[model samples]
Target: MKKVSLFVKAMGLGLLASASAFAQYNPKASYEGPAKMNTWSVSIHGGPTQFFGDLREYDFYPVGNTNSDSYSERGTWFVGAAVGKQLSHLFGLQLGANLGNLAGMKRRQYFSYFRSNYQQVDLTGSVNLKSLLFGPNKMKHWKIDGYTGIGVLRFKSTAYQLGSGRVQRFTKHNAGDGTVTPAGYEADWVIPIGAAIHYEISPRFDIGLDFRINHVNTERLDATIGGDNSSVYDQVGSRGSFDNTLARKGSSSLDKYGYGSFMVTYKLGKNAIRVKKENGKYEYDTTKGTYHLRWTDPRNLIKPPVILTLEQIDSVAKANRPKDIDPRLLLDSDNDGVSDYFDRQPNTPAGSIVSGAGEAIDFDKYVSAALPGIACAEIFANVQFDTDKNIIKPQYYEMLNKVVELLNKTQCRLQLSGHADRRASDRYNIALSRRRVEAVRNYLVKAGLNDANRIVIDAFGSFKPIGDTSRNGLQKNRRVELRLVP
Candidate 1:
């Protein structure tokens, strides 16, 4: 009893150590973290139990002893249930219980047979073979586990004769060494080792097959000692000195049984299933909320970091960078509406009203002829703005007032195209330029210009720069051009 208690304590400590190790496996990625995994489950199984001992006649079939009344089938049925907890993707623990009957007979050496009904409980550790070898996502719906454990078995056995229906008894005198217990139910230790293959049908349940062999610690399980001489003793367990003539050592062979069962497991907790995208990538927690620890490997769940070469990085930067300013939008040497590329007169006087071709126009003569149905001359000038400022300066007010007077006198229209420097984003610059245009147009309306609708406006942000974006050209680029149309 003390040895069994110490073994149980050792197994408990081992399970706790394993659980600690698994709990500390924190992945770098938060999405692949194991904190939300489903870890608890329950299972039920039923199958046939095959007993192996000294009373067995054949390996799988009871053949030679069938003619004698001592013949007994060596196979019986068993039912069991278990509850498990998955500590990690690679390791788990299960506590299971089984009730079964065992039978075996032999007629060659000894006309003896025994039947036993047994119950056992085990605490086993399971190793996930599938996820350990392949990745978690490789065989998403299948699981294979190998397990081994120690437990206690309690059983009652009855030994009988072939034709006489007489019960066989073994006392301390005839049994030799008194190792065999009296004829009744007895308790002993057992070790179970086996493997299982499971197929997950859904998030909640799984179906699988399990095969295990239980090694009992006692040789009295069949009520017949192994290697007992049949020629010397007419009946089984009939002599105290049988070991002297026995072919093998004293009680060398222990008793064991095997169970091949079909099992169904139900998983408990929120089990997140993986979703496969059209691009052949898998995502967890899209359909369900949390992953099951039984099938999820923390390392495999992490998404690989994207890697790019230097050339690829440079290509992306070039593709998204803002385009260069149009040279034609700049290169106007004079403050005229025309660029130098198209300006016939490249250098006009400052503040001079210029035509579309950059030629200075006679403002008074054009205004007088335009009153007599003569068309008004197209004149252009620029209103400069400070960096990021939408306020029209006092110096440009005089020029604007003259244009307002011309608009009130003649049926002429004013076109204002506003611009800004490249110190800000395109969206912000466009809004600043629009504000500048509105300021100038409001000033014209307050200055008694007729038909405020005659003013047309356009706001072009840093995209259409009239000069380079350097210190000298910034103020020039941040200006509104005024074009008077007939």
Candidate 2:
């Protein structure tokens, strides 16, 4: 019981240590499905075996003197083969069969030597150490396991006289019954418990060492059950006139045998190789000849909105800004209070009462011109046009009315200057500009101006631009200006 307690404690400690190591290495790990093959293995083992039974001495020495021999003489050889299936990383099952010979000698009162040939079959459950402790990745080259199982053992034993080398066969039948019965050799239940360590030398091959102890339920494995002296002496007679006593001198404990073996195993199924992918998924790469787990987009995982710092915002704002700008041109290019867009007289003098066109007021010129009956001041607006267009817009009707009123009141001739944007060739622009002048002149003549000849037309291509040739500048250039001719 004490030994059993110690063994249990040791197994418990080993399990606890394995669990601790597993937790440390694979904190968030989970079991992946088995690879693309069935997990099965076949193994063969052979090694030394030792037996402990009633016919053996208690001391651990190995000498046979018909008086003081040891149990070490019971050591023999065993060979076996097994097939196993791995159910998971932590557990597996095995079914195996073993054949071996067991022998023992005792010389206390009468010398007796017993030899047995046995065949056993077992089914076992195993705990995989590498998988349980540090996962399959750590099990690449080495593995360890503990196993236990129950099986049936069949054996045949013979008792031999030492000096005469005479053998006596034990009968399995009870002749007291009237009916003749044949007892097949001894058959008993056995429990096999053991541990093994293995090294994988190749993808399909492994070498290992196994240590196992088989405990039998019956004490008659040596052919001596109870300590009945007359029953045994009658069977072999007196050896050299000495009484041959086959009585059991050892304790009434059941028999137990153990084996220490070297084993070789071959995996019988396809290898399950895992391939890793870049996006958290699994796929097989033919070029690399391996399977891998791939990473995937994290759409399933929660993400927070990004919050930018003030410095980052500032950097983005300034990235597209120009390094320098002409302040004078941006504000008032001609030193006029009005900006360039509204400044019709972009070169206005520093101090002058200017109209909204940014031109200096000329009351004397207006009064003088009016006194001569020429209403030149009435030409206050220019007729604008769409790009490359000659037709007059409806909104310009009122402005044209003012021009007609001034022309009717004045005796002076009016001059129309037409211009175009710099979009086409010079000849094309000059033609477009002349058509604009003709359009304005024809409109005025149709609006009841008696002397159509009083209006003179002139055209200028984009060579005479009033501003930079930007979109707004082009629109400004595509116009017809009205001015009184002196």
Candidate 2 TM-score to native? 0.46
Please write out the lDDT profile of model 2 over residues 1-486, one tens digit for every residue: 433453465456445544543442333542233223345778999998777765575545544344333333635799999998754455567899999988776655445666778899998877776655565544345678877767899876665554554554342533445432322366777877889998766656779999998877666566555354544453453332212222222345667778899999877744323334358653433333222111111121224478889998899889977878554345444433345766778776543334456676653344334643643433323566898799999977765664565567677577788888888999999999999999989888888786787887889877666545687666767777666544
Candidate No. with top TM-score:
1
User: Model 2, stretches more than 4 Å misplaced?
Assistant: 1-38, 58-75, 130-140, 168-184, 226-251, 271-486
Poorly placed runs, candidate 1 (over 4 Å):
1-35, 62-67, 169-183, 230-249, 271-282, 307-486
Question: Clash pairs of candidate 1?
Answer: 272-290
What TM-scores do the predictions have?
0.54, 0.46
